[model samples]
Target chain A: MKEATTSKIAWGWLALAAVFLVYPLVFQSAFFRDIGVLLLLAAISASAWNIVGGYAGQVSVGHGMFFGVGAYVPLMVFTHLGWPPLLGVPIAIVVVLVLSVIVGMPTFRLQGHYFSMATLAVAELIRLLVGTWDFAGAAIGLSGPAIPRGWWDLTFTSELPYYYIFLGVLATLLLVTWQVQRSRFGYYMRAVKAGERAAKSLGVPVRRTKLFALMLSAAFTSIAGSLYAIKTGFVDPESGFGILVSVQMLIIAALGGAGTLIGPLIGAIILIPLQTATNTWFGGGGSGLTYILYGGIIVLLARFEPGGLVELWNTYAPRRWRSGSHAP
Target chain B: MLLEAKNVAKHFGEFRAVADANLTVAEGDVIGLIGPNGAGKSTFFNCLAGDTEPTAGTILFDGQDVTNASTETHARLGIGRTFQVPATFEDMTILENVMVGAFMRHPGRADARAHAEKIIEMTGLREHAHLRARSLGTPGRKRLEIARVLATGPRLMLLDEALAGLTPGELQQAITLVRRIHETGVTLVIVEHIMEVIMTLTARVLVFNQGHVIASGKPQDVVKDPLVIEAYLGHGHGKRARKRGPAA
Candidate 1:
């Protein structure tokens, strides 16, 4: 009976994946394709953020530093050395590792709001540094060098190729998240989340576990940043390192369900369209209304349903048909 | 000695919580640590558990110095401790809570689960195995704490106020559980206020008063010591408090 339910959940996920896989193909519109790309991109970034923000319960507001690092590195390399944008992926991983250590080692030691404040400061510092650096184009920002449209350079003319590329990246990140959720690290993360003191007493190396989570989260977020840079073919410190960029990822995770595997993806699916619609209907002024609506929804969720939409789904959904086990 | 501490002291700024406290416990010994409120008993216990570093002293477990080891290191070194307020992982199921401890020895999830199941059974928490810890009452939470610590495979267990919030019936059951734990050959150092539970459960008693060891001996001898009596009551009210009992 348990196996039957498990398989049923598996099929449900596959069906969802199938829809996502062919979404752009069926819609056959540039606007729909753009939304699909942005949705998957946000899903990857939000899910990556969930590793530290949700599972470890460390609310990082400086993840934009990692994302900007990922975004800026490839664009900078392409402009200066005429290198392929894909090379930035590997370099971004190395940069994020060192950056995560620098940011996490000291900030992770602080508890609760202090940690968030520290991360916020670090993110702001990174943004200011990038905006002032001449090599990184200062505040003017840098765009990807016009290269021949090819897989090697990752500079495709059609939005379709970019869509598939991001889909692949999102799929890989989701797999990594799933593996993390099943590992011993997942258990330790939740343990630390619930009570750091008790987790340490039980022999969990609390600081190191948190650092590991941060490193993984930053690495994944950086990759998503690279993907975003390639998709847009432009990078600015504002778009890359802005606090809004970090907060948007956080909102998607929190709204969809921070800790659950599908939460961020679901969040992106609901939010990306809402954002696009508001920006289109209200033009430049509508962006404020969009953020206001998001802020209001977040407040409501925090007050009445702290676990976010996933909890609502779990509570209302049939017991037998619940998608996944809540156990660590 | 299974555990030995020499000149353990802990000071928080101008205040001294534990001053020059010394202790030694043999394998299979059950020692009750009893004292009045604000007597620094919990401070001394925290030092021994490596939850906090001693301001000055050395703690030797099985002849190895572990004075500044972290609490996680202390657990890995075969020391398990329960908290004063019963720190069960509130979100986890009771079985999952125990499994975290079991994971110390058996890193494999299946092995940890099997070991945790045995502990759940032993602690009589089998009925509540699937329940979240936050839903359990005080006694259940206490047992969950002990059961989790036991699953860590500790040679020495430090229990702080494990019997504080129990009903009389639950107190008796807890005593039986502690006795059962002692029977399993694990050394125990229990910090508790209930004089009756301490007297019946512990073979030796260590009494603390104002950051000092006032007395250390069998429960009856330690309880009757004049300084311990005075510490519990006032200097002139020893007779009144003594008549009420060693701890009331």
Candidate 2:
């Protein structure tokens, strides 16, 4: 019986992968491809946040620090060192690693709301500093390759390449998340989420587990940030290290179901288009109406279903369709 | 000796929770620690289990000095323990809850799962392996805590009120489980309020009063100690209770 259910899940994932691969080709429109790119980017970063926030229960609210670094380092290297922005990815990863350790070490000790506040303060500090630092284009910010220097510049007229690139990265991130869910580290992460003291009594190295998760999460968010810079062709302190960017990651993962795998994708599926296309569809006076819709849904979900839409699905999903083992 | 404590003391500012407490355990022994409420029984148990650091003294486990070690280090060094209140991971199923402890020995998921499954079966939680821990009653949650510790494959186990708040049938089952565990040769140090557990299971007993070890001997003898009788039965009642113990 268990084997049958496991295979059923396997089939479901394979079918989803097939859809992702063919999504752009089937749609064949630039606008549709743009939505595809946004969807993938949203999913990638949100899934990254799920590691520390959802599984490890670290609840960092300043992930934009890593994201900003990711966006800036690539462009900084391009203009000063005359290297391709994509090649600067390794430097971005290294810098993000250093920052993650610094941010996680003391803040992780504070825990809960304190950790969130610390992360937010650090992210805001970085943003203000970047606004003044002339080396990073100061407040005006930096721009990527104007004319197509080459394929490596990632500058293009169509969103097709970006759609594919972002899709590939998202797929890789999902595969890593899948492996984590089945590993011993995954068990330790969940244990820490429940209670650190009890988890420690069970022989789990709680601090080390939280640190590992934060570092991994920051790295992936950096990659997504790099992708964002590549696609948008510009990144300022506001665009790269914006508070909205961080909150968006948290919301996307949470409202879709924070802890469960693929929750971010579901979140991006509903939110990205909803947030972007609301003005046209609703014929409203811009983002004011969108915020109400977004905030309203979040309020309802937080008050009624803290577990998010995934819990709703688990509770209401058909018997065979439900994740059988977790049904209780 | 499999375990030894030399004047282990835990002090909270001016208040002493466990002061100058000492005990030793042989490789396959089962011992009991008993006292009236606020007699510091749980505090002494915490000091020995490494959850609370001793203000002074030494602890040796398996011939190695483990004084000042953290609870995680103790667990890694083959000392497993259950909390007074069941701290079962509410989000996980019974098997998953046990798997967290099993991961200490078996790093791989498959091996950990197999080991955890064996522990759950041994603790009689096989029927509830798929059920979330939040759904369980007090008895099952306590057993879950025991099963979780058992998965660590500890050389010594510290059980804090494992048999408390149970129905008669549940108590019998829990006692049986403890006996099955003892038969496997795991050294056990139990902190229990029920004299029946000490009378029937423990070979030796230690009595605590006002954060000090007032008496130590065979369960029957310890129960008859004048200081212990006074601690439990009070100053006036102790005189009349000297002829009888909680159990003969």
Candidate 3:
């Protein structure tokens, strides 16, 4: 039984990997390819957020701070130090690590809603600081310097390179998720999520587990931020550190089914396209309509299927596949 | 010594929950701690288990001072406890619930699962191994709680109201399980309102009233003590004192 389950999971990964590898080849339309890039980035961010939000049950609404830092560090380095955005990747991750710990020291100890609020405040603080700072281009934000397009500089004109880059990023994050799911750390996170007191009693080291999860989450989120900034070549304070970005990540993870390994990817696949389609077709002038439609979908999902689409599928999916996605 | 608490006191705001309570238990001893509803039995247990630090005093476990230790620290130091209310991870399967505890000692998943399986079998939860904990009945939940803690390989186990909601058949089985755990050479401190189980299971009984230990000794002798009778039957002089059972 165990061998069968392991083989099934291996096949699941192989099948998904095969699909992603050939997706760009099969889908020739540049528009669809761009959408694929957006979906992959969203999935990466949401999957990163899931480490803390889904597994540790620490719903953070301030992850945009990490995302913002990820974008700003590389952009600043490129503009000021004349280095590629790739150079800031490690620095952004390190900075976010320290920030997450500082924020998590007090907030991780707080209960659910309060923890979420604390994160929101942290993101807002970063946004306000960046908005006023002249060195980081102030409220206008930093624009990637016009440099020679190359893999080393992480700059490219076509969407295909970015599509593959982000696909690779998503793959790494998914691999991390898979390892965590099968390891002792994954079990501890689930225990903490299920019952903190019970987890503590069982020697799960609740605080430390939460902090570790937050660090891993922040690191991945910063990577996503950097990649997103490089692709766009521009990142304003509002675009980088906005609450909307954090909300979207939260919605993607939760709407997919929080604790499941593939939930975030599934959520991004559905929500990103739906969002783009809605904005293109129904959007008359501004974002109000798009937001209202998005809000309504979120409300409906929360009301009718709080476990999200993955859970809905799990109930009806094959028994062999059902055991592979252990939902919290 | 397995455990010792010196002048331990726990206060929630102005209200004192456990007041200057001192206790000592030798290795491999089954000790019973009994008190009325608000007599601070659970509070004292929490202090010992490191769920809540005492407002004042020191707790020594396995010869290490652990007064300010976190619950995880206590757990790592081989002090395991159960809540008065069943506290299983409702989303996890019965086997997974126990395996979480086993994971503390055994870092490998397969080893933890193997150890947990044995515990589940011993606790008579083998039949329900794959069932989610939320689907369990009262007795099953209670046993599952014990199975989880037992998997932690605790040298000293504190059970708070383990037999609270069991049927007569379930109660007998639970009593046997407790005995089995004790026979494994784990020191035990049990908090039980059921006097019969306490009397049979514990070698010594400590009576608590208003956050203080009023008496401690052999169970039969403690039950016959006039002060214990008053504490249980009330201080008012009554002709019905002799007729009242301690648990009743």
Candidate 4:
């Protein structure tokens, strides 16, 4: 049975890989590849958010702080020092680690919706602060390298390279998430999510586990932000630290299945295309629709099925496949 | 002694949940705490299990002081416990529920899974290993509580009314399961509402009345203590106590 499961998983991954491999070649359009890149980026960010919100149940709505810094630092560094924007990725990760600790310490100390509220508050605070900071380009924001100085500069006219790059990053993030799912820490994360008191009784270090999860999540979210800047060649306080920026990751993760491995990816698959389509059809006016769509799904899912699409998939999928998506 | 709680009192603001609790548990000895409703049996149990810190007291586990230690620290120091409400990870399967505890010692997923499987089998929950914990009723969840605690490889285990709502047959099975676990050399401290369980399972009994150890001795003698009768069993409970058979 174990061998069969293993083989099935391998096949699943190969199939997933095949889709990514074939998409660009078949579509052969910049628009499609841009959508692909955006979808993967959203998936990466959502997956990172899942480490804290989904797997560990921290439910942070302020991940835009990590993402904003990630997007901002690289571009801001380039604008200030004329250095390669990619160099700021590591700096962004370190900054996110410190920020996560600062955020996690106080919020994790108090259980329940406090973490979510604190995250939302922090993200907005950062946005407001960034809106005034002249060094980091203030509300106007910063731009990436004006022109590619070298191959390392990562500036590209084609969306294809960004698509592959994002796919690689998303794959890496998924791999890490899978490791967490199967590891001892992953088990602890679920235990912590179940109930802090029960988790404590079961020998799970609840507070510490949450802190670590937030840090891990923050780091990846920062990386995703950096990637966004690298691709877009620009960053503004509104784009970098916007509430919608933070909320999108949460919405996608919740829509798919908050804690499941492929939940964010599935959510990205469904939500991103719809998002791109509406934005294209409506031009700049699609932002309001996105909010309405997100709010509607959140309310409906919260009331009807907080377990999200993954739970539905688990219950409705073939008997053999039901065991694959373990919901927690 | 494997465990000791000296003058432990839990006060929530001005109201004292447990006024004073002193208990010592020797290694390999099984003990029971029985009390009338609101006599603070569960509260004292929580104090002993490190679920709640006492307002004033010291707790020694395996000769080390751990009065203010967190619940995880207690577990790491070879102590494990079950909640009165039968706490189980709702979204997890029975096997995964046990595996979470097994991870305390096993650390590796495969090892934890193996240990959890063995625990599930021992607890007679093998058939339900893959079923979500939320699907379980009270008795099943109580059994899961035991399975999860047992998976932690504890030297001492505390059970809080684990058999409270079980049917007669389920109670018998649960008693047998606890006996089987006792035979494995883990010391046990249980809070129980059932007299039959106390008489059959515990080596000694501590009778609580209004947050105090009003009476304590072998189950047969302790039940007859006048203070225990007046406080717990009410006025004329001695005759009924006498009718019950000796400890098993």
Q: What shift in Å separates residue A98 of candidate 4 from its native position after superposition?
A: 0.7
| TM-score against native, each model | 0.94, 0.96, 0.94, 0.96
Candidates' chain B TM-scores in the order shown: 0.95, 0.96, 0.95, 0.93
Q: What's the best-to-worst order under lDDT? A: 4, 2, 3, 1
lDDT of 4 by residue, A1-328 (tens): 5467668878988898899977998998888988888999999999999999999998998999999999998887788888899889999999999999999999898999999999999999999999999998888988887689998889999988888999999889999999988898898998899888998988898999999999999999999999999999999998999999999999999999999888998899999999888889998867699998899989988898888898887777776776532432
Model 4 C-alpha lDDT per residue in residues B96-182, reported as the tens digit of each score: 899999999998888999999999999999877878898889999999999999999999999999999999999999999999999
Candidate 3: misplaced stretches above 4 Å? A1-6, A145-149, A283-286, A316-321, A324-328, B237-248
Docking quality tier of model 1:
acceptable
Give candidate 2's error at residue B200 in angstroms: 2.1
Please write out the lDDT profile of model 1 over residues A77-125, one tens digit for every residue. 8888878878878898899999999888987777777778877898899
Write the number of the candidate with greater DockQ, choosing between 2 and 4: 2
Interface C-alpha root-mean-square deviation, candidates in order:
3.7, 1.4, 3.4, 3.0
Clashes of each: 0, 0, 0, 0
Candidate 1's displacement at residue B235, Å, is 2.9
Poorest lDDT segment (10 consecutive residues) of candidate 4 chain A: A319-328
Q: Number of the top candidate by DockQ?
A: 2
lDDT of 2 by residue, A1-328 (tens): 6678789989988998899889999998988888889999999999999999988888888999989999999899988988889987879999999999998888777656877898999999999999999999999999988997788899989888899899899999999998997799998999999888889888999888999999999999999999999789889998899888898898899889887887888999999988878866767566577558668878988799887888788778886777655644
Show model 4 residue runs off by greater than 4 Å.
A1-6, A324-328, B233-248
lDDT of 1 by residue, B1-248 (tens): 99999999999998999899999999999999999999989999999998999999899999999999889999999999999988888867898889888888888888889999999999999977876788888898999999999999999999999888888899999999999999998999999999998889889998888899889999988877777878988786776665666553
